[model samples]
Target: VGSRCGAAEFACRVNAAVELLDAGAPAAEAARMLADRFDCSQRQARRYVDRAAGGGRVVVAAEETVVFTVKLPAPLAIRVRERARESGGTLSALVTRALTEFLVRGQARPRLW
Candidate 1:
């Protein structure tokens, strides 16, 4: 059901939504287009439009939590850190979100072993 990947993809959709607004399309019309194009719920599309028209990038809230230590290969770690930096989000938030999304998917593929 993930028609869009992450914030980057969502930003692209927001840009398109902005273009629609500039073209004199109603907010509802823009939301309808987003819902149709992204196969997301109309409610979700409307939320997207709200953020787009709200005058800035959509934001994620911070949570209070404990910290853990994990290790990864240098290259992967670097890439993840880079992505977090470029997105203006914390490494913890990004990794936590990704892990949560993956684990919550009941259909996550099983290993052959």
Candidate 2:
């Protein structure tokens, strides 16, 4: 994990992926290049390449952290994802900020039992 990848830089990678595809390069080739360039996992690089090749919307948000998973209500999960997309932030970031404020800053009110 590292600092967030800038929009321009991610876009450049996608653009390069597109160019590579157009140049008759194979999917694996593009993915390998991306992995080497970004020092990311092969799976993640393939994801980047596949998403770019599919002509679908792609967004990149890097955060410094370890993997932490918790189940949430479906609606809450959807809302968080939507907020991240709309705000160009990551779920990890939003959750980290919220937890820091609530637990560290002592700003959250007591919940009803």
Q: Which stretches of candidate 2 lie over 4 Å from their true place?
A: 1-3, 56-113
Top-scoring candidate (lDDT): 1
Q: After superposition, how far is residue 24 of candidate 2 from its true place, in Å?
A: 0.9
Looking at candidate 2, the ten consecutive residues that score lowest on lDDT are: 56-65
TM-score of each: 0.46, 0.45
Clashing pairs in 1: none
Tell me the tens digit of each residue's lDDT in model 2 across 1-113.
34456665766667777777888879999999887887877777787678578753444445445678899999999998998777765576688777878786554566566
Computed on alpha carbons, the lDDT of every model, listed in order, comes to 0.77, 0.73
Residue 39, model 2: Cα distance from true site in angstroms: 2.3
